[model samples]
Target: MLLTQYLFQADKPLKTTIRNYTEADFNELIDIQKECFPPPFPSDLWWSEDQLGSHIRHFPQGAICAEINGEIAGSITTLIITYKGQDHTWEEITDNGSIVTHDPHGNALYVVDISVRPKYRKTGLGKLLMQSLYHLVVELKLESVLGGSRMPGYERVKDKLTPEHYVESILNGERKDPVVTFLMKAGRTPVKLLPDYLDDPESANYGLLMEWKNPFFEKTK
Candidate 1:
């Protein structure tokens, strides 16, 4: 993929800016996630007063958030393959082993979760979260960012990808997720699986894996 030859615009990011997460941002984060996701994560996800205390201690500068004109709109929890002084590259995350882990040595950023209240969906806040995660990865010096290209409570649905990537950003639907647009703006390419690696991902819609990084970040910024 010759991104440099394709069309460059690092001077303008996905039209969204980001900031750090804070207490005042918790309620909105909860509201948006709740509105977009179901079965909600542990109640602590929303009511925890330890909000910043939880992520900041774990990710330090990797936990990023955003606002739309002073209003809290979106947030993302990021883990570097290498964090602080330790590396988490050997760790694997699972939603009941439903999704497969392909790369343990890949340099990528995983977006643990992202949400923009239903009211805000299709309105660009989700794009903000994607952009913020992209920025966080650059600061951490990572090459790619990955997360489930998922629908909220996605296990009940089927994925579209046949095989998942080491780090995948995917979504379900008859169409590509708006996040795909932002991802393209950031420059992560999809993997072309070897015939042996081709198989249905255990999660929904095969898994719409997307990746982003580098010149995409530099040119967009």
Candidate 2:
């Protein structure tokens, strides 16, 4: 089944709440990353305390968490940047995850990371977190929300297909990638295929550039 179908399957409503992640949530964020991106995903790539601090300090509005029954189930971290609207690497754009480059006056919201604990994956926590980010884009009047999504399914076919072809297959409905498909259903459009975007062997170091334009974005004079 496609991710869209799976993610939307009938289920009981969750007692969930989405709110900005605070310094108090730092340790939980670390645990979530481990559950979401275990080994083969380099431990170094996980968010550091310094990086989390940068997120909360630089642009707290762009960093959010989801709670289910008062337990932190997932989180999304982001920063505001004057997007150059060109091909770029994850480390470069995110300042190696510290986001010290976050510009409060920038016009775009860049998603640095989003993670949901394994136990809560089916509770729609991911969707809720993304919805919060979408709301942030509109609330800040940014032009768009940008993110690089790993294609964990890519490594399986790396020997048989190039990264570009892999993404094309997903886009054309000839294939299904959990991360890619889920993001598509969440309203993110794939605008580029990025290579060496991260150190995840599962994705073969490939990432998909996902964008969601703010429908309410307006040019200022």
lDDT score, candidate 1: 0.46
Q: Please give the lDDT score at residue 156 for candidate 1.
A: 29
TM-score of 1: 0.54
Worst 10 residues of 1 by lDDT: 1-10
Candidate lDDT values, in order:
0.46, 0.83
How do the residues 1-221 of candidate 2 rate in per-residue lDDT, one tens digit apiece?
00111233246556667788888988989988888879976799888889899888887777888776667888888998887767777898889988888998998889888888888776667776777788888878899999999898887899999988999899899999989998998889999977788777888887899999999988987
| Predicted candidate 1 versus true structure: per-residue lDDT over 104-147, tens digit per residue | 34366665556554544455555556666666666655666765
Model 2's alpha-carbon lDDT is 0.83
Cα displacement (angstroms), candidate 2, residue 153, comes to 1.0
Error of 1 at 31 (Å): 2.2
